[model samples]
Target: MSFYKKDNSDYLEQAFYSLQGQTLPADEIILIQDGQVGADLENIVKKWSQRLPIRLFVNRENIGLGMSLKKGLELCSYEFVARMDSDDICHPERFEHQYNFLKSHPEIAVVGSWIAEFSETIEKISNYRKLPSDSEELFFFAKKRCPLNHPTVMYRKSDINKVGSYFNFRFQQDYHLWGRLLNSGFRIANIPKSLVYMRVDERLFNRRGGIRYFQIETQVQKTFLDIGFINKLEFIRNYIIRGCIRLIPNSLRKNFYETFLR
Candidate 1:
């Protein structure tokens, strides 16, 4: 997992505590410090390092999520890597379930699960993101949206590397990665249960809009078209749909996410 300057110390502690509570605990937990995440978080990381099997890697400068994950992926010494966000809470059986699923289904390279979205507390989950149940549905669903919940995923390191791993997409890095994975014939699936409580608020909706974000979204769509994941017509449709969603007022965009995307 990767953390930045804005991550809450208490949340980071809770996230790590969840990992510690896992039934199938991680062999090596890679915690990448994206830039300088301040002293309070650093102290928490240092404390957890002594408690959990955390292998810490510090970045001298702030490098965004994609590059930070790329670094973390390189540092990971295991075959399968489960991803967790520093501010999110995981169910105790998440790792065990995903690990077993991977072992039983060798054809599937990435396995994710539903995520419960909470605002301030994990206790009061406000929304749940239920994804397509199998790889076939997930591949088709990728034409318009991200098929898997990013924070709820455990993927194979070798497969992720084979597809060129993560890239530098600022707004929708996971979506872009899914496109390439699906296009390259790698299979992905989602367990039909929620395994993570993802923190979300108005900012989550706000972060997905605006002119610059729309430009990046367009670029991602173009990349999809070039990769043969989507044809020219579907690309135009996605552009129009995304344009409406991204260029709209923030309140309307929030409603769009709530009414449809979630």
Candidate 2:
């Protein structure tokens, strides 16, 4: 996994601790400092490396998360790659469960699990679970919005390479990448289990983030249209639904999403 740090060193440490307690730990942990300069982060890195094989990648200038992930993937020596954000915590059996599933089932190129949301207080924000398991169900949902949780996904290195690396400098690289992967005839499957804790709030969808998401959604819709993933009438339905959701008040939007999108 690749981690980028800033003043959120505390949460970063917590994320690492969660990793340390994993039932099946990663062979290597790649930590990237995306131009975050602080004594706290350095100390945390030093402290964690004593027990785990942590490789540190430092950026002289700030690069976006997409670039950070690409860099991490470039340096990864493993066949199966899993993603974990700096603020999220993975379940103790996350890697073990995903690895075992992938090992037993060779057809799925990418796999993600259900996710739960948490606030800064660590309280459950609300319901945030999804239940589309195979490619057909996942594509059914993806036609409308991102059905995969970015941080809870694991992909085979060869499959990612076949599709191409994460989009460079894009606003919603994960969302766009999923679209392209589906477009290319790859299969996606869900583990049917909650495996990670995600943090969500108003800041996650402020003006800038809102605009970014809209751009991604538009691009995804266009891609869907291009490949006949959905008819014009269905596209119109999804476009209006997504547009209206984007316009709702942030609090109401969160509730609407938890109720309907999942």
Global local distance difference test of model 1: 0.92
* TM value for model 1: 0.98
Which runs of model 1 end up more than 4 angstroms from their true locations?
none
Clashing residue pairs in candidate 2 (N, C-alpha, C atoms within 3 angstroms): none
Off by over 4 Å in 2: 5-7, 120-125, 169-171, 205-209, 227-231
Structural similarity to truth (TM-score) of each candidate: 0.98, 0.88
Show the lowest summed lDDT stretch of 10 residues, model 2. Answer: 205-214
Clashes of each: 0, 0
Please list the Cα RMSD from the true structure of every candidate, rounded to 1 decimal place: 0.9, 2.4
State the lDDT of candidate 2 residue by residue for 45-137, as single tens digits: 899889888999898887878888888888888989899888888889999999998898898888999988777644555556676878788
Clashes by residue pair, model 1: none
Please, what is the whole-model Cα lDDT of each candidate in the order they appear? Answer: 0.92, 0.79
